[model samples]
Target: MTTYIPQLTLPEQVFASAPASILLPVALGTTVGYSTRPKQTKETYNLIRQPPLRPPPWVFGPVWTVLYGLTGYGAYRGIGLNLTSILPGTMSVARRAATLYTVQLGLNLAWMPLFFGARRPAAAMLDVLALLGANAYLACLFFGTRDGLADPVAGWCWAPYLAWLSFAAYLNAGVGYLNGWDISDATLRRRKAVGKGAQ
Candidate 1:
């Protein structure tokens, strides 16, 4: 089977670099986490019905930081370097891997906004489900290429992330179910206000 190789643009080249690749995701994840307001997110988490085995809100930051770093390092090792000279016939695989990496990164970034910012647990659950699938495929792509490129380190980096996503999916689903699928802060406030007025 033939796989199409994509040409990397200059910005892509910068992003795929050793430092930038790793820093970008970590930075972006941190930015999104903060932009959504950590205090508010923590409050929301406390307000909602969490699933059994849900970790404290504090755990998410450090865990995600580590995962993001691992993801970045994996990209740097698996997709950024020019394998043409070292491993002939691996560029196509690397390019495809890079494309997948970018795609999965976007999927990863969308979940926080969906869950916290928009206050949509159902949508966030769906987003994480897609993210899980995409990362699974990406991990496979990183682990072994059709043309005999094998980078176990990169693939292994995704292992923890995949496991976490599984747990996250459970948490997402559990929260949605426990809350009767409605956890909107605005709705909750409106109902309270209506109750006061009626009384």
Candidate 2:
């Protein structure tokens, strides 16, 4: 009997092998995204009419920290599988998945700014919808059953993120409905005016 291990491509050897390196950028990206919001945004967020199901504000930080870590690990695993696969066409599928993942991350980062910093829940909801779509596509790619790659572990890894996004979509929709602002460019301006008047 003979055992064979697929050789890692140069890129994989340099990048995919170290999960920590992949996770480092994810953590930093999330930190930068969070920092984009003004300090006043937190005060505004706390004052908003959140849905009854909304978790306390403190919950978000811990949840997101765990989610970011899991997502980074999942990405690392998916990329490693693709890079080291002996199977033809695996890398292409993985590349597509990675791209979608990147796009969703961007969308994720954009939501906080749109909702809290810019005070535009409507715009944030749009970003959330796009994020949901990208996340679903990425999850399917990892599951690979339909696509024939079959990496259940990687697929499961994305479960938390998907769940969180779904909850967030509900929250975003609730906020938009409660605030009476959706797709209206004037909403932010109106909010600013009201904030100024109150001050």
Candidate 3:
């Protein structure tokens, strides 16, 4: 049997293409997008109406920073390794895991649009519930694959997202209660006040 030898030289993209690295940029860009949806200046209330127990806006930065880094890498490694191992058409555990990952990512991206873009808290809640289901699906797929490395890592990556959305869901529900379906009129007044205050 020949001993496998390690090559000191590998493709640059191996490191460059790392999933973890992708997370920082996507997250940073997403951050910008997320922030832009808020008031024009000064500040409005926290993104949602909640008791003071709610986390500060600053907390989200640190929390998502860690979570996104882990998420991008875990997802990248899981799908990357598995996809490279087999044909796309193969019915294997890796393929299954990869598919679930894609679904979850799609749901994750949808939250911003449904909430901020459309300002539909009710619709956003529904989307988040679906997001929850997708995360559960991904977790189960990861655990069942028995791949050792991917399962727990993948599951762990999803936990914070689950927690954040859970909080957001509650906040959305409460705000919808305190406000109403169309907060546009109220929100516009608030934004104008905030923008004026900044000046």
Count clashes in each candidate, considering only residues at least 3 apart in sequence or on different chains: 0, 0, 0
Determine the backbone clash count of candidate 1: 0
Give me the overall lDDT of model 3. 0.56
lDDT, candidate 2, 1-199, per-residue tens: 1111222122344227556635664676568656865455555665565677988777887788778777777777775567567766776666556555655677887888787767788888899999888778777778776553467777787899899999999999997887666423354356556862331
Question: What lDDT does each candidate get?
Answer: 0.78, 0.68, 0.56
Cα error, residue 19 of model 1, in Å, equals 1.6
Which pairs, if any, clash in model 1? none
RMSD of 2: 6.8
Comparing 2 and 3 by TM-score, which wins?
Answer: 2
Worst 10 residues of 3 by lDDT: 1-10
All models, RMSD in angstroms: 4.0, 6.8, 8.9
lDDT of 1 by residue, 58-132 (tens): 999999999999988887777776344365577766766666677678888999999888989899988999889
Residue 154 Cα positional deviation in candidate 3, in Å, after optimal superposition: 2.0
Stronger candidate by TM-score (1 vs 3): 1
When 1 and 3 are scored with lDDT, the better candidate is 1
Query: Candidates 1 and 2: which is better by TM-score?
Result: 1
* 20-86: candidate 3 lDDT, tens digit per residue: 4446436654665466564531143443344335666676556656666766666655544554654
Instruction: Please list the residue runs of candidate 1 whose C-alpha ends up more than 4 Å from where it truly belongs after superposition.
Output: 1-10, 82-89, 145-148, 187-199
Q: Write out the backbone clash pairs for model 2.
A: none
